[model samples]
Target: MTTQTDLIQYLLRLGDSALIQGQRLCQWCGRAPALEEELALMNVGLDLVGQARNWLDYAAELLDDGRDADHLAFRRDERAYRNLLLVEQPNGDYAVTMLKQFFYDAWHLEVLQGLSRSSDERIAGIAAKAVKEATYHLRRSGEWVERLGDGTEESHQRMLDAIPLLWRFTIELISGDDSETRLHAAGLVPDAAQIASAWQARVEQVFTRATLPLPAAPSYFYLDARRGLHSEHLGTLLAEMQFLPRAYPDATW
Candidate 1:
């Protein structure tokens, strides 16, 4: 059975991933290499944050907790966050950030597509709405990956370097465990293995177009952020993202 705990945990995982990644992308607010790219990134970040709000709101409802999306997103400590390690990793360079987005957006699009068909009405509803946004993110990142990878030699090398550095974190996105197993059996979620196939196909297509060689898989590093363990970067990210609200403490506009 998909217990309430399982449902809440699952939703929190989704929310945390979007929230953290969106925050990371927002750091490029005024820093993108070009004005057009800056606007694109900001638009993508807003989409992710919007998706995060929906998932977090659902999670809060499931928990019967009064905590809103702001509280869940900003008020939590590092260890309390359920985001993947990849999303929290520092945005090293343009190539690195683009690669990270490419990897994440591709997988997330598949996940959202799968979830859109979930038997759980709430999950399906959120996924139905989110999949459209995720699709655009995937397309934008894919285009950038291709441009960088097929551009100058320096850009190609930088993108190639990013592949190995970030590839290790990709495994967790499609690997299911007890929580997923329970959800799958209860029709509350889709099989991770299925999502993996779609993710791999999409990634391979983008990489091929980018003229980038895929990195060999790395040794698995299992950090279950769903259980609240997070990368060191998450602390700093939360501090900055939450600064305004934390300083004001529920002050309204």
Candidate 2:
């Protein structure tokens, strides 16, 4: 593929994951365990949504197919989404939510940090801005993981239960495909191995503090989100998220 195509795909991967994950976090607006936590979650979700706009905006600019960021975000079918499988999974209990957040934050920070130094000025600028938000996200999620994992037996076990449910999808977190390889070659993105290594180290450090055992890395699932194959949950999510735009195609905000 051309460098332009690769970059667009990479941006969509970044943007779609942030959009979906942000939407998932917003689901906790009224349901978070505490008031302060609810506010924090919402703020983080907003941060991610803002980051998604930055990415999708750039992707739309490059595509230049008459679709703006809103159209790219809301008008796409599930088969067109390039988000990571980990981000699209349904949020379960608090433990499940935090652990999932921690995992994604870990990888997200690494990828953002790497992109912050991109040879492409636009990508570097966007990543520079995003890295700050991702850093706080990782720290907050990491602390939560430690708190719940080392807390009461029930909370700890909930984290344990969360492991098997989320762990398998993590393979996609570190696994880079051809588009990423092309970007890496062009210095538009970071080395996938380095990002994977850093991601694993962060996960290990947080899990060690949380007193949770890290499981063996599992094989990729039959479906891959980077290739537009997502879990069934994505369709349900898109229905809710896209309803407004689809229903009012000519309405202006």
Candidate 3:
């Protein structure tokens, strides 16, 4: 990004989102509605984790700190995390999870599209690789949202009910703060406001295809998640994800 601090934080935000989403997806491995879905979720989870490693390792290199990807992923407390609120939210039902995935995948693809053209060659390369995986994610989630929203009575209602609650957090994804503003000006990242337009267009297209109504003007009353602010759920999630690392310091697989 613009500076060491900016790049570090940006990478943390990127890597953390992928790590948390990967873990959340894994939670559905045994619980998905069907065997195919179960396998699909796990595969996507692995993809996210791989992305996390690439981002975090490069972040650690920038830091020149003793920390590695595992340390950043496991040793840090909840408050130290910079993942988006959309990702850290608990996955409710299948429809809820799919809608959340669709939202994130849409945003992820846009972010990668911008980053793929970045002046920073490393970031651009990573974004190039990630774009392929993210495209698959958006396709998978988008199809599921359409299917569930237009499917039988119960599935449609589930999607309808899940949208509003999760919709609030999507705003933060597109409303980057001062840090992002600086980075955007330096050509390190895309302007979220501009990216927001692209994100909205994609979301609207998917929603229309799904027969789901779009929120006319959804309010963003949630915390400023870009700067490490998080919901209560992150604490519990970190407690488990960090337990082994904290308990057995310097442990290796």
Candidate 4:
């Protein structure tokens, strides 16, 4: 029942989330708490950007509308973005950053693990390569969550404070819209319910170790990113990210 248009939109969701999340991580390059941590964050950001390019490349090809990956990433307005709401949120304190990354990394790994078996070979190949990087990302972020959550009183309190701010956005992580359902039914993507179950289990396991309390339930604000709705932060982010390309549309890199 799914058409190529559905597939293109689904790919955009994956590509956009990686692109925005990578940009958020890069914002910490000069401000990370330590040099070593800064380098790690940059490396992770680059990995996500690379993955974004791969997904966007395929999406561009499917569209056949003369736009390349760069165009799709840099030319789109905020309302056209399909990234998850969690990634668009501003990077708060280090604790908030780590928790946000942990939440996303957890869901990302589940989705990529399922996509590794995608009916489309290109998708499967991309997912297979991304799985290695995502596995490392999740492990690194999960460790940070534990270190800060269980470390000192101040760090522990910060982690606790971050939970409520970031938890609500997590509703999007386990839930999929109609496009995803169509793909899954066609065996082109993973089952949404299965992805949700795995993501939730991983989150619960990590939270238990960090001694962090899990939100009783996930909630969302008025917007849904899957439907081309996004947080206000995304508009600011896109303005900065897209400035050069828009200003010099004819310029070649």
lDDT of 4: 0.93
Per-model C-alpha lDDT, please?
0.86, 0.94, 0.89, 0.93
Ranking by TM-score: 2, 4, 3, 1
The TM-score measured for candidate 1 stands at 0.95
Write model 3 residue lDDT over 5-51, tens digit each, in one string.
88789999999999999999998977999999999999999999999
Better of 1 and 2 by TM-score: 2
Tell me model 1's lDDT, rounded to 2 decimals: 0.86
Q: Write the per-residue lDDT of candidate 2 for residues 16-105, one digit (tens) a residue.
A: 999999999999988998999999999999999999999999999999999999999999999999998988899999999999999999
lDDT of 4 by residue, 142-211 (tens): 9999999889999999999999888989999888878888898777899988988998998889888889
**Model 2, residue 141: displacement in angstroms?**
0.2
Global fold similarity of model 4 (TM-score): 0.98
Candidate 3 regions off by >4 Å?
Answer: none
> How many pairs collide in each candidate, listed in order?
0, 0, 0, 0
- Locate the minimum summed-lDDT window of 10 residues in model 2: 217-226
Give the poorly placed runs of model 2, Cα more than 4 Å off: none
What are the models' TM-scores? 0.95, 0.99, 0.96, 0.98
**Candidate 4: residue 28 lDDT (0-100):** 97
